[model samples]
Target chain A: MIAGSALYQTAVELNRRAAICIPEDARLAVGQLCQRETHSLSRYVLEQIMENYQVAVAEQRPMCADTGLPRFYAKVGNEAVVEGGMVGLEEAVRRATAEATAAIPIRPNRVHPLSRKDQNNNVGVHAPTVDYSFEPGVNWLELTVVHKGGLFGGDYRMLFPADGVAGLKRFLLDSISEFFRRGMSCQPLVVGVGIGGTKDVCVRLAKEAACLRIVGDRNPDPDIATLEEELLELGNSTGFGVMGLPGDGAILDVHIEIAYTHTGGMPIAIQHFCFAHRRATARIGADNSIEYRGNPCWFTPFYRRESISFQPA
Target chain B: MNNLEDLKLREVRLRAPLTEDDIRSLEIGDVVFLDGVLFTGREGLYSQLFDLNLQPPVDIRSLSNVTFHCSPAVNELRPGEYHIPAVSATASFRFDKYIPLLFERYDVRVIIGKGGMQKEIYQSTFRKYGAVYLTTVGYGLGALYGRGIRSVKDVHWKEELGLAQAMWVLEVENLGPFLVECNAQGRSLFEMANAEINQRFEKLYAGLPQPKLKRLGEVTSPTCEVL
Candidate 1:
């Protein structure tokens, strides 16, 4: 029998992962405004996030007080297996997640959107999206995990039209603009542009796009890269000030997952991932090929708050 | 919060341009019950206006001491209905897009939102044109209601964004428990909150290995600050 110790350690790591986030500077700005200020309106929502952080800590409460439906992304190596790793990976994650949550005092934020009753953050039919990209010969439990707790679950959208005339930039701009007009706040305004693929595949592809590893950076493809740049610029210009800042706001990264799309049309839909992007993504590689990029880098991230005694003047 | 019976509200059409003479004379706290017509455009409208290099949909010259914000009307509105309330939806951020334009093209004054604003916009627009931004309750939709018959006018990007409708209404007694942060002057608590989230993100990511350092207070962003 695979001893349960492996499960315990993994859970601890996941808990640590829960409290951390790595939103890039640009993307961070957008998230703040998108949360309350709306998208397309401001350039400096990240500033508001600093103030909000103070509120979350001073209150000693969950940020936004809306702990989200837990979503974990665990990347594992092909050769490196947990010693006595017999209990299925899914079970290990589920079990570990439950225990770690308790240890960290993570808020019981999972609630039925309709019923308004807390679910105590447990997995029902499909609570966590366990995504795995297999590495050939890596060993050791090395993974990066990040989750967005306060946000509402983001929706999954596919923006590819059958006619195929509307360019990617047009679709993305239209999608984001519409999201802001809805008048909702703190809702993660992430656009998962699934290109290529046929029918369902396109949507599935789009869903994958929503979980980009690099957050908001350019895509590898040249055509997609251009569109990404244009949309990013247009999104900030919407004058929708994020977190309520006036003009130009930081937006969470825009991700695009492209497959071989059908020739019929270009259909791009916008999916609003909950209030905070509480989904965590980490990799457990035995070979250690993937390393943290930035200085003082580690696979882990942190959360911040400040003294309320000193207010911004 | 007096009922409409006690409040002074009636509709008035724009016969000529409203000058500073109109805005300066109004009392500071007395609720200005506006009738006649106003645009119901939100973000898309803002984007379109930005594209056109203009202010809002209303005839600018005729707008003085006018309020600009996004609001959705609850309760069905018929052609000649007497009762309906236009509740403020999202406090807009696009005011920057049109604030200067409003002051320049029309001596329009007054905007609305759920929080305070930056000083420059306030001074540049309000100080110059006697305009000020009003902060309304962020989620007090039910609190604002009165009756007026109206419907949507033109929608720019109507295909994706629905009707950029127009509705006329009477806002009642508690126009809002909107946070005190909102006023014409300029200062955004929202900006501070955004900055806080960014800094904490750095600290949280850095301290992941040392999980013992985790404190719920440090782990999450705060909920209330606006007094």
Candidate 2:
């Protein structure tokens, strides 16, 4: 059984990693963008961003002061068992979040929405939310933490089936036009598109698509993957570059995620993962050995299975 | 990697408590780094000073004429000692209503933050005060900016406003790579970029059709900004 202590320790470490380190996948993408960028001003901005990444790692400081809203994604194995079950694991994560806030010295951004009262620990009612998905044939628990800025760059809309792919493209363009101006969304970033499901689920999938996946990974479905490539091309063709300056491209990659929804409505959501792009993942084995990794491997075949039943591949 | 020094963008450095000439000399799109002291402020400080009519805990004009819209990743190392590892600007557009108060009451000459305010603010308030706005690059270069901070000059209202919302005065050496988003002449770099960007919007939207249904208060014009 995985001890709660191990969970707590790993959670703290995940927070620190997410706070200080820009994952290699994101780093490489930005590095390449900086090198190929043609516009002098946008290229200069990208260069400074690259330098900031180096300084953050060298000095062991948060890449972004906003630190956004810190949250977690947990993938649980069918055979995994913990010392106190799911509740204990949650407790461990919550305790670790508060501890890491003060220790890593990340700004305690969470506050009471109406009262605006701050606990100064980044923990409060429904703060630092944890989302979960399950997989079969393993006994390890995998956790990924994402620190995403919330003020801008996410929108949802309902479209009829008749609207189709053109409508989807239009919506993506609209979001880009809305938030990408003045670098409000902080461009040269990833764009995540969620194609279906209930409104909330669609938004959630969009966020997960943006935050959970590694830079280069694509959806396994061929048609959806093609859509991802098309949207990416369309997004980059906007002539919007870093800080909303005109240049080669603003988007690093486009990710599309989908789920079955009501027959009449084709709801969609768009989320932008900015250059800060801070996230980290780890897998805790049944033996309690923690292995850190850049990729979260969130969208398993089982997780996206369409049939009523799920089977291990 | 390309050498940043080779870039053609004009760069300038200025010390704080700037004079009218110091502010007016800046041009839109010029890169800037700042020296001397600056303080952090946002809605909390704004409402306190403007709404609550609370006198500033310290003398504002004497401290510095520069204020940053930011909150640092800081920790109290000892009873009154603090350490900040990273600092980045917050979006300044939300505090638009307080700009006049800051300029008139505090005589603030320099504002540094992320993004920037609407063009109207620059034309009216900023132009009148002879102040310029500098926008932090990457909008998240917390570590790079943090390195320029020489010391924590003071902190106020920690208990009342909480750490994130409290007023933090910092002494900085070369604190930025901020771009001049809004200059004293009331020109805005973002507005200039938008004019060029908006020209391409028509072609991008030409093949796509409007949605069958629209939400209330939806912006129909592709070229219109929602800000």
Could you tell me the lDDT of residue A183 within candidate 1? 26
For A230-308, candidate 1 gives per-residue lDDT tens digits of 5555555544444333333334556665554446544443344422333333343343223332211121111011343
Reference contacts preserved by each model: 0.01, 0.78
Name the regions of candidate 1 deviating beyond 4 angstroms.
A1-7, A20-46, A53-62, A83-87, A111-119, A140-162, A165-170, A182-190, A198-208, A243-246, A250-252, A263-269, A272-313, B1-227
lDDT by residue for model 1 (B1-227), tens: 21111222222222112245544443322233344434344444554555565444445444334444553422223544323223333445545666676556545555555344454566565666555444442222221321221333322233333222232223233233223232233433343433433332233222122222133443232222211
The C-alpha stretches of model 2 lying farther than 4 A from their native spots are B1-8
Give the alpha carbon lDDT tens digit for every residue of A1-313 in model 2. Answer: 8989999999999999988899999999999999989988899899999999999999998988887998989999999998899999888998999999999989999999999999998889988888999988899999998889999999999998998999999999999888988899987789988888999999999999998888889899999999999999999888888888878888888999999999999999999999998898999999999999879999899989999888656
lDDT of all the models against the reference? 0.40, 0.90
Q: Which candidate is the best by TM-score?
A: 2
Angstrom error at residue B89, model 2: 0.9
Number of colliding residue pairs in each model? 118, 0
TM-score of chain A of 2: 0.99
